[model samples]
Target: MLLIAGLQWIVGPLIEYASPSLHYKYYMYVEQTQYMGFVVPAFGIFVLFVLVLIKKTALFNFQLGRLENYSNYGLVIFIIGVFFDVFGGFLPGALGFVGFILSNFKFVGAIILYYSQSKKLKKIFYVAILYLLITSISKALFHDFILWSVFFYMFWSLKNKPSIPVILTTIIAGALLALTLQTVKSAFRAEVWNDYSGNKIELFIGLMIDSVLASDTDVSQIDGDGVDSNVRLNQGWIISATLDHIPSNQNYFNGATIKDAIFASILPRFLNPNKTKAGGQENFRKFTGLELSQGTSMGISIVGEAYGNFAHVGGILFMGIWGFFLGKVWLFLYNQIRKNILIIAFIPLIFLQVIKAETELVVVLNHLVKSLIVVFLFIWFAKKYLKWDFNK
Candidate 1:
C-alpha cells in the first residue's frame, strides 16, 4: 500500500516536477510549491489509512475447518472463471454481472488450489506465470499478474513472514517488471492494435525479445501515444489540476457528485438508468471543467473528489472517514479468515482497485458493494446447498 501510494502520489510527481522539461508534453497546471503543498497533506492521509488498516492488535482465535473436496472444488471454480472470461460479453443485461462476479473466481479458485497443494512455492510460480502469459497475450494488460502475485504473497506472508531483504527484493523486482511492461506495451499495442491479425502471442513474444535485444533504444523516449513510466505513475497532476480549477472557474459540486457515487454504487443501471458511468470521464469533465480527447481518460482522484465537494478542511476530514471505513471493512473480513481461510480469497477481489489512488469514489464504491454482494451470495450458497458449514 505504502509503495503504491508513494510511487503514484509522491515519487512519480517529484520525478516530473524535478524534470519538467523531460515531460513537457504532460505539463503541470500549477506551480511546484503549490503542487507540493496540496500533495504532502494528501499523501499523509494515505499514510494514515495504511496505519489504520495494518494496526497490530490481538485477533480473536476461531476454530478452523477442513473443507470437503476443497482442491477439487477450487479447480472447478477456476475452470468456470476462465469460461466467464472468454465469453462473458455474450451475456445480456444483468446476467453480465454474474459473469463479472464469477470472473473473480479466477483468483479465488487459484488461491484455493495453491493452499490445497503441499508444494506451495512451485504451485504459485506456475499459476502466476500462466496467468501472466494469458493476460498479456489476450488483453495486453499486466496489472493482473502483479495483483495476483501480491495476492498470493499476502497468503504466503501470513505463515512465512519473509525477511526484510526478501521483501525489498520482491518490491524492486515488481517495480522493474511494471516499468518494463509499461515501456514495451505501447510498442506492442501499436503493432497489434492497428490491423495486424497475426498471432498475438507470437507478436508479443517477438516484441519483448526485440526490446530486450535492442541496447540502443531509449526506454524513456515516448513512442507516439506512449507515456513514460514516471508520467504514467504520476496521478498527483490530476489532483493539482483539480485544486487549481474547482471553485475558481466553476462552483464546487458540494457533495452532489459524491451523492451520485453513493447512489450509483447501490443502484444498478437497470434501476437508475442515469447512474454515473465507470470511466470517470463524465465526472472529470463536470468537476474539472476540462475537455479530454476521446481516447484520453482521467479521473479526479479520491483526494480531488473530496476537495471538490468540500474545501480543504472538509476534504481532509472526508479522507480520514474514507480511510477509517475501508480499514474497518478490511479488519472485519480479515477476522473471518480465521474461521474459514477460503474467505481470504475474496480479499483481493474486494480491494483490487481500492489500492489504486488514481481511481474515483464512484468506481471504488461500485466495485466494493457489488463484490461484497457476490461474496456473501457465494458463501450463502455454499452453506445452504453444499451442506458444508464454513465454520466446520
Candidate 2:
C-alpha cells in the first residue's frame, strides 16, 4: 500500500523527464532538489527496519486460529454502513460526515468476520467495491477505490494462500493503474464529472476500467487533486516539500501544528465555531505558495507537518512513534477481535487510517477520534437496545 502511494513521485520523474511529451509536476523538484528524492524511500526503509526490530523485542506473540463462534454483528454493522454509503451520500454537512463514517466501517469489520467465511466475504467485498467505486466516480476522486483495494489486500492476507498468483496479479494491476492514474483523473476532471448526476452505474464502471488501461484516448491535464486527479495524492514530496519550503523561507511552524492537532482531537469544530481550523490545510498557502482551489486540496502529509514543525530528526522520531502506534493498535485490534467482534470494530477503523498519508495530523487524528466516538455511541445503543453487551 505504501508502495502504491509512492509510485507517482518515485517513478514519475523518470517517466516524465525521459519522455519528450510528458511533463510531470515533480520533474522540477527532482531536477533541482535531487537529495530530497531519497527522503521518502529512505524513510520507508527505516520504518520497515523499525517494525522488524520491534518484533524482535519479545513483546507480542500469539498462537491462535480462527474464532470458533463467529458473530453476525459484523454483518449487521456492514449492512448499516452500506445504508450510509448509498443514502447518506444525499445527507449534507455534519450529518453527511457522520453518515459516511458510520457506514464506511464495514471494510474494517469485514476482515475478521468474513475471513473464515470466504463465500459471504466475497459478496460483501463486491458490494463494498461497488459502493466505493460509484462514490469515487461521483466525487471524481479515486481514493475510495484505492481504499477498497487495501481492504481487499487485507482480506486476502488472512488466507495466506499457497500460491503467489494474487500477489503477482496485484503487482501487475497496481503498476498499470499507477502508470495511467493521472490520465484517467485528468479525463474525469475535464470530461466525466460535469454532467455527473446523470451518469449510470455502467458508465462509472466503464470509466474506472478506462482509468487503468488508458482506454480513453483523449489527453488530460491533471491539476493535482484527489487520488485519480492530476496530483500525487500520497508521496514523499510532502516531506521533501516541507524540508525545502520551511527554514528556507524561514516560516517554521514551531510546534503550532502538533498543538493544533491535539486540540482539534478534543474540540469538535461544530462546538467551537470560531476555532482555528487545525490541520495542514491552513499551512498549505504558507508552505506551497498555492491556495487550495475548490474541489482541490494541497494535501499535507502528517510526517511532512512533523518535519515542518520539528525538522528532519524530529520527523524521523515521529515516524518511529507512528509505526509503534500502528503496531500496538494492530495487536490490540487482533486481541479485541478475539474478545468481541462488534464494538471493538473501532480497532480496525482507527488503525486503517495509517494508509491515509495525505492528510495532516490534526485532520487524521480528529477524524479517528470522531469515528471512535461514533462507534462507541453506536455500541452504546447496541448494548442498551440490541442487548449485545459487547464490552471488552
Candidate 3:
C-alpha cells in the first residue's frame, strides 16, 4: 500500500477512472517519463532486496496476550498525550519539549488499544477512538489517516474474519469515505486551521459534520482535470522532481543531509540547544525550484534525498542499504516483543511514519532518534520505578 502511494503514474487511473468523481490531485508522471524508466528497475531491485531481508528474518512472532496488563495505563497515557500535544504551547520550554517527545511515542498506546479492544475492553476502545477523531480532525488526520487505517484493517480482519461480501462492502465504503474526507478536509483546513478567535473545537466539529452532511459541495471543489505538473504536492511529485532535476542542476547534496541527520540524532535539542536544522528545506527548494514561502516545508522523500546525494546508481545502492537497516531494526523489535519486552512497543509506534511515508532521510532519522530516546526512558522508569509487569 505504501509503495503504491509513492507510484503516482500507476495510481492515476484509480482516482481518475475507477472513481471518476474523486478529484484528488497528484504530480504529473509524463514529465519525468524518461527518468522513471530508471525508477522502475530501481524499485524492482528494492523489492528483491526487501524479499531477501524477509527470507533471512523469520516471520514476526507477535504475542498479543502480553498486552493485557498495560491496557489501563495505555489509556491514561494516550489521553495525556492528546492534551499535551493539543495544548503544548501553554507549557514551558522543557515541559513542552517533554510533551512533544512523549506525544510522538504515543503510538504505543495505539498498539495497546488494538489488543485491549480485541480482548474486549469497550471503554478503552470506544473512548480512545472518539478522542482520536477529535484530534485527527484537528489538522493531521487528513494525511495521517493512512497509518491508522492500517491498524483498523488489521484489527478487524484478525478479530471478525468477515465474509467476502462484508469485506468488499467495507472497502468500498472506506474508499468513498477517504476520498470524500480529503475533499472536505482540504476546505476545513483552509477555513478552520488559521482562525482561533471563535470556539475552535466547535468549529472543527461543525466542519467535520458539515463535510459529511454536505458531500456534494465538498467533492465539487476538487479539479477533475488530470494531473498538473506545476501544482505537484504529494510524495510522488517530490520524488519524480528530484529524479528529473538532479541530473543537470549540480544540486547533488552527496549524502550531506544523512550525515547531518546522524549528528542531529546523537544530540537532543534540549541538551544541545544548538541542534542544527536537519530539515534540508534549502536543498529541496534548490532541487525542485519551488518558490516556497518561509516556515513552509517542501517534503522530499527518502527517495529524493537518496537521489540528490548519489545520482541513480548510488541512490539505489543507498536505498538498498537503508532497507537492510530498517528491516533489521523492525525484525529485532519483533523478536524482543515475542520475549515480552514491553518497552519495545513504544519504538514501533513511533517509527510507524518512517515505514509509511516517503519522508526525507533526515526527518526519518530524526524520528528514529526521538523514538529510541523515548523508548529507553520509558522502559527504565516503567521497570525500575513503577514496577509495571512485563512477564508473559
Instruction: Using TM-score, give the best candidate's number.
Output: 1
Candidate 3, residue 359: Cα displacement in angstroms equals 1.5
Residue pair clashes in candidate 3: 254-309
User: What TM-score does candidate 2 get on C-alpha atoms?
Assistant: 0.75
Per-residue C-alpha lDDT of model 2 across residues 1-392, encoded as one tens digit per residue: 34533553444334433442333333233242443444454457546744674464345432212421333666777777767867887876646557868777677556445544557654665666666777776677776687666656654554565357877887788756755655556556555556655565555456556554443333232322323332343354454555667768756787887787777677766775654454345777665544566645555666667677776676666766666665665555556555655433355466445556566677677767777678768877887899765442
Question: For candidate 3, what is the TM-score?
Answer: 0.78
Give a tens-digit lDDT track for model 3, residues 7-98: 44234422332333222323433244454655555555666666676674466545555566678766655666666667777878645545
Model 1 clashing-pair count: 0
User: Which 10 consecutive positions of candidate 1 have the poorest summed lDDT?
Assistant: 60-69
On TM-score, who's better, 2 or 3? Answer: 3
Pairs that collide in candidate 1 are: none
Report the lDDT tens digits of candidate 1 across residue range 1-392.
56776777778778887886355345567787877776677668856975767575245442212422366666666777778878888998766776787887876777666656456522743675577667766776666777777777776665457999999998898777666677778877776668678888887777666655656455434233546667888887777778788778778888888899999889888899888877788888776667888976677788789888887777777877887878787777876776676676678888887887788999988888888888878777877887755543
- The 10 consecutive residues of candidate 3 with the worst lDDT sum are 223-232
Please identify model 2 stretches exceeding 4 Å from their true place: 1-68, 86-96, 108-122, 160-162, 196-234, 274-280, 341-348, 376-385, 389-392
RMSD of each: 3.1, 4.9, 4.8
